[model samples]
Target: MSQHVFLRGMVAIRLFSALAELTGALLMWRFQRLETAVRINGLLGLVGPLVLTTTMALGLAGLAQSRLPAARLVWIGAGVGLILWGTRR
Candidate 1:
């Protein structure tokens, strides 16, 4: 509905796709089953939450982007924090 929403959706989709790839790779490496229905399902399972979070984050960001600059800054800050947290973990 908004630019922020669109961007967030794009980010979520990108993240989900990335996780799917990772899951597929992991399954193939660990199970020796690359072309199975179960592996595809497993990938989708991992991707589902990512898609939801992406949508939620974008929606909140979109709502906040119009009302306050602080909201936007907080979103950016959260993203940076996530990156840092990810790297550290």
Candidate 2:
């Protein structure tokens, strides 16, 4: 509803994204049993980015009608893109 709320949401989203990635990596490393492997990998592979894109879209949408800070927006955009890019492969 407010910029403060959206900013906090973005921070939480970023933090959760990092944690999801870490969890995924840990699971991938520690477990190799066939049955749960795909489930874990699949969950890790798809869910994190889904949440990420959702949050990024929300963050962008929240500022869409407002005049965004150009420099900060660029930096934030780049950082988010970088994270997505790094995690993609």
Candidate 3:
């Protein structure tokens, strides 16, 4: 895919993720119930990682066509892994 496509995809996913979070917060506030808030938060938590992985994947795909070395790519992948691992419960 072209770099423009990759960039657009990455930006779009992040925007969607942001919208989801804002909507989740609004819903939690509107409901004004602990159970409903918790459920919304739980679903938002899933969106976080999915968005992260998708944006990173698009970035990596774009980088794959660039001059960056394979070893650097490995390091980047490891960094992303560490991020996911560190954030896990």
Best by TM-score: 3
On lDDT, the candidate that comes out on top is: 3
Candidate 2 differs from the real structure by a C-alpha RMSD in angstroms, to one decimal, of 4.8
Question: Residue by residue across 1-89, what tens digits does model 2's lDDT show?
Answer: 67777778888888897898788777866886766777877877787777777788778767753778777777877888899999776
* Candidate 1: count of backbone clashes, pairs at least 3 residues apart or interchain: 0
Worst 10 residues of 2 by lDDT: 61-70
Per-residue lDDT for 16 in model 1? 65
Candidates ranked by TM-score, best first? 3, 2, 1
RMSD of candidates 1 onward, in order: 7.6, 4.8, 0.9
Model 1 regions more than 4 Å off: 1-35, 68-89
lDDT of each: 0.66, 0.78, 0.92
Models 1 onward score TM values of 0.40, 0.55, 0.94
- Candidate 3 to truth, TM: 0.94
C-alpha lDDT of residue 73 in model 2: 76
lDDT of 1 by residue, 13-67 (tens): 7776777778676766787664675757666766655565566566556756567
Better of 1 and 3 by lDDT: 3
